[model samples]
Target: MTDTDSLVADLRFAEPDNPYLRDPGTSFHPVDELDPETAREQAAVLRDAVREHDARYYTDADPLVSDAVYDTLFERLQTLEETFDLDREGSPTRRVGGETLDELDTVAHVTRMLSIQQSVDADEVREFDDRVHREVGDVSYVCEPKFDGLSVEVVYVDGVYTRAATRGDGDEGEDVTEQVRTIRSIPERLAGDPPGFLAVRGEVYVPRPAFREHNRERVERGEEPFANPRNLAAGTLRQLDVSAVADRPLDCYFYDVLGWRATAPATAEPFSEVEDDDSRPDTQRAETAALDRFGLRTVDRSEHVGEIDGALDYRDRLLDDREELDYEIDGVVIKVDDRAAREELGATSRAIRWAFAYKFPARREVTRVTDVVVQVGRTGRLTPVALLDPVDVGGVTVARASLHNPEQIAELGVGVGDRVRVKRAGDVIPQVTEVVDDGDDGHFEFPDTCPVCDSPAERDGPVAFCTGGLSCDAQVARTIQHYASRGGLDIEGLGEERVEQLREAGLLDNLPDLYRLPERRGALAGLGGWGETSADNLIAEVRASREPPLPEFLAGLGIHEVGEATARNLAREFGDFETFRSATVDELVAVDDVGETVARTIREFLDNPDNAAVIDELLGFVDPESVETDDDGDALAGLTFVFTGSLSEPRRVASDLVERHGGSATGSVSGNTDYLVAGENPGQSKRDDADSEDVPVVDEDGFADVLAERGVDWPPAE
Candidate 1:
């Protein structure tokens, strides 16, 4: 058996196969290269960094790096620890999750998150069967398309659902009892007597049909899409308010039975999809059928086969069948069949040692680069994008994919009009995987400077950026646009259109200058497009925005390596704006998510006299507001959310909600978060991360519940 250290080393050698681990393959720092001590330190450092990024990226849809970069960092961390003696309990190399969150009200499981016996391929399955036959003397195994979704524990008290929780650490989880109640398939009121108190464990998922429609809307609207149905399903179940779950098209597949009533507990249920083609049910199989008849969405039991080879053949057939099936499946999940043998095989601290996920390769397709565009990000970085001729790759369109940077363009050797092989590298974001041709009139001429500001761009590593921060109008336009953004000041009258108008009219220069308009109300009150009333309203909004919470205030500043979500995390830990600014590198890094790089960037930004002056000016405008905002936010705030597809949020609510609450609303979920305020059908990305993190969902009513939870203990002081 591979000890934890040997396994980590194997992981180091293994190419991280997930799309989220996307990065340049050429620069991979093999884990074998690092010495033992260095591997350990690297593991700890990267573990903290990756966890923070995952929380921000998956839970909040707020990422500081592209998916490729995250993958790159994660894989390298794995490599270092695996090749050396550097494995930690909390090693980022494991790619599992953080320590069980404390915020979730504790729940003790009736049964432990049991281990799964695994088979990655047909050969492994045969080996598994060989061993099972030797031990249990002619036993079987169950195989099923492990629906790519979340593992759920369902508790029914006398045929009525008592509780539902995510498979957090396979122990206790955030009690999402309220949210699960809304899942129509879950049946809050079960059929027949559900064995007094039945605790059923199953995989809850969003159907592929729903997932496709959801992502279509997301794509059209410019919101992030869920990677797969499994992610969407997992995210959906964790909604704080069950009503939010009602709108979603969700379903479940019962696999293992974690617990049952005192009377039923003694009875064993056959493993789902057991490998017994010639099944005249042994008593356990009969019980499994009976349980399924009672309305737990159990897998199709008849598909099980006796021979491991036959099962692999069945597994392959199942993968093909997945194309026709309504639900999503990443791979075939094979588990031990005999009930007694499964118990003997046992489990592990993290995943089930018995079961394994044999993920399919990311779907790839070829497409031509019809055109190229340089998109200027909020931070003024010019990223090259490929405008494709619209081809489908990995069940999604491959048009207008990000090249990431100029170097990416050169590496692919692609230009304005060239043929390229585009792929959804990790079944996630679409990128030009490689260039198949140099089909062009000439070689690609990479931009030497910023396209918009014409600033001399410098490549510091793999990224290129416009260095003119405050001086360039393009930079200022983006900055002010970001400042007045919903995640920033949340000024009602200052959306991008209004920001453009102000910038064009020379009414606003930067974030801090907006405060000046209130003083110059007379001038603002008589602008060409605005009447006295409208101008005064704008002035008032700007004045009102001045009294921001520390989080919102920090986010509004538009610092590099910071977003509203990250800002809120920093503020909560630091307490106030001044203290955050004064913190040392060590102190900043001490925050759960903040790393040395983030800490240094923050310190460097604060040290600038110009930057400090902006903070000082913001301080003078008014007292700091709340640390965590609430339901009584801008009209769009505190809405219980599950974005099936997309919406207009564009990741701005973080800023907008902050101004309203005298605190901040962030992107991801944690015990401390107020709500999963969402729009449209948000991608499963946030929901999945939230489910794992154990945050509650809320609709308008739930929002009210949270507000009342916060300080609405008494009616308005009227």
Candidate 2:
């Protein structure tokens, strides 16, 4: 029998009969009426039963009991734990998740989590096979889907789940133990007798169906939907509230183990030395089998092959069935079966030599472009968008694709009525790639004037901008909406539709007009679909935002090239609105992440007479507070650090450490940069910049030495 078939057979035979399956309603008993011992015993039984049901549903995908019955059993278990205080750390009841974390802590991985070398060409795959055969000599290969989702490392101790972390930088990752505990597929305790210490790598993902449904619900509620399942899953896993993470339909599939120990260690050390056990799996296939035996969910579709041709066939078959799969996979991963062969091949700083990812071509569809229209954004930038005949690409019906700028349109020579090949870049944004047919049309001419407000449209390099700024109706509505968005002043009642409604009614025109709405409360309330209560609530929210943090105030302005991070940097650098508003380009360039382009953009926006008047008018009602700094030491006050590539800790943690020591941590390498901290697999562009700029490049250890020399601790105190 095949390995998957044998696994299914084993699961079927070992599956326990749930006592609550027949009459779930009859299983309930008041916790108060039961004795302590009775409650504890019943709770244990319920936990085992619930775990079995979960395993059947999640891992095997063959649930014997209905969801209602499972819920009833689970609810009863929770009640028993809450009432009689019979809760255990590994109980299934804890999956409901009420823990709140202030922030995710960093933890070291037992072993390095190296990336796989990937290629889109079949020749590259054959080349990799050649290299493997030259060293390992006719080794078997294991092929599995390369899941496109968040990678994490999960650790277990003595058959109980202990910690889980994001694959931040291979060496260390963000601790997400609380978030991972909520995934029902992951067992709180292993099903069979397992290793004392185990660290496995897996992908956390949202199933496509769940992702679509969630996005649909978000749209119905007038909230912006997530772009894709991978992004949604990553964002959901990072949520500080465990309850919120539990609410999302997140699942995981284990593929590889980083560390394993057969015997229990005396101490609670994460990675303790142990003699190699004969029972340990020696091949990739055997390792997966071991993972399955322990009740960890591994992909059942993976296959073992003796040659590269069989591996290629498996990849082709997976590509054919890609859309039907529950999770998103970008490619097929082929790994040398023998663990000893892998060890012999070894690895580079970034990737393993024994494994290679053969990626599929980007999903593309040919559709006729009906028209090209210019869209004015909140920053008055005009983006040419092509409206196309609706076509399905990667299961998503795409009707429009971005042309980006005039240069893109010219380069592609795309015109109305042209049949163009479109692909979803990063599987999220649709873009026109090539023209399949000219369709008997002349080259489309881009308009020289603003389409929205009939203002002068000026070209800056390849990009076109509407000089009307906030005066343009399209720009006005979007700008005001962004100003009140959650990332901005966070006015609760002012959503996209509401801002459009107010603009259509001529009750609102710009940012300052939103703050002036209380003066015209009667008119606002009398508007169609708006009542007195809604108007009052909106006015109150606007009033409440009269005094905002300096960062929020800067972000609310919707300046070109300025986002939340840059806004925060500006606020930290300038301290107050008056100082920031009057700053020249030279002064603005001193802020972290503010290059000449961004500095000039800031200066031009602040220097505009119309924009200055609007700001002055808004200042009559709004007060922006100075940003406070927590840096108490000037250890590295004059030095500026730019980080690139993977470090021992997350780049954010490293950046925070630098900022805490009164040093500037910028995103890019420039002439002003004092040091470029290059880690494993550093970006080539940053390294080139460091070389050209004559900036010193330091490794992680070198950075630590510099910190020591400055009298600052390497890893900051908790």
lDDT (CA) per prediction: 0.60, 0.82
Give the best candidate by TM-score. Answer: 2
* Model 1 local distance difference test score: 0.60
Q: List model 1 lDDT by residue over 1-718, tens digit each.
A: 5443542332311223322222323265455565667666656656555654544442233454687787778777766665664634433333232223223355766667654544455566566567666766765556667666787787765565566777787666666665555454454444433565567777778765566666544432233455456666777666544545666767666766665543322222221211222222333355466565555556663355666676677777776665457666657766666666665656666665445555544444765564565655557676776655456686775555778877777767777557678767678877887777665555456677656556556566888765444444456667777777766777788777777677656678765678788777776666667888898888878878767767677777777777766776777677776677788999988864588887877776677555566567756765666553234544434433322223333343334343344454445556656456444566677777667767665443444455566554212332
TM-score of each: 0.41, 0.55
- Model 1 poorest 10 in a row by lDDT: 270-279
Model 2 C-alpha RMSD vs. true structure (Å) is 21.2
Counted clashes in each candidate structure: 38, 0
Per-residue lDDT of 440-558 in model 2, one digit per residue for the tens? 67767778877766766768899998766555666777788888886678899888788878876778877789888999999999998888999999999989999988878898888
How far does residue 195 in candidate 2 sit from its true spot (Å)?
Answer: 1.5
Model 1 alpha-carbon drift over 4 Å, by segment: 1-103, 117-119, 239-243, 262-284, 347-429, 432-539, 542-718
Alpha carbon deviation, residue 413, candidate 1 (Å)? 21
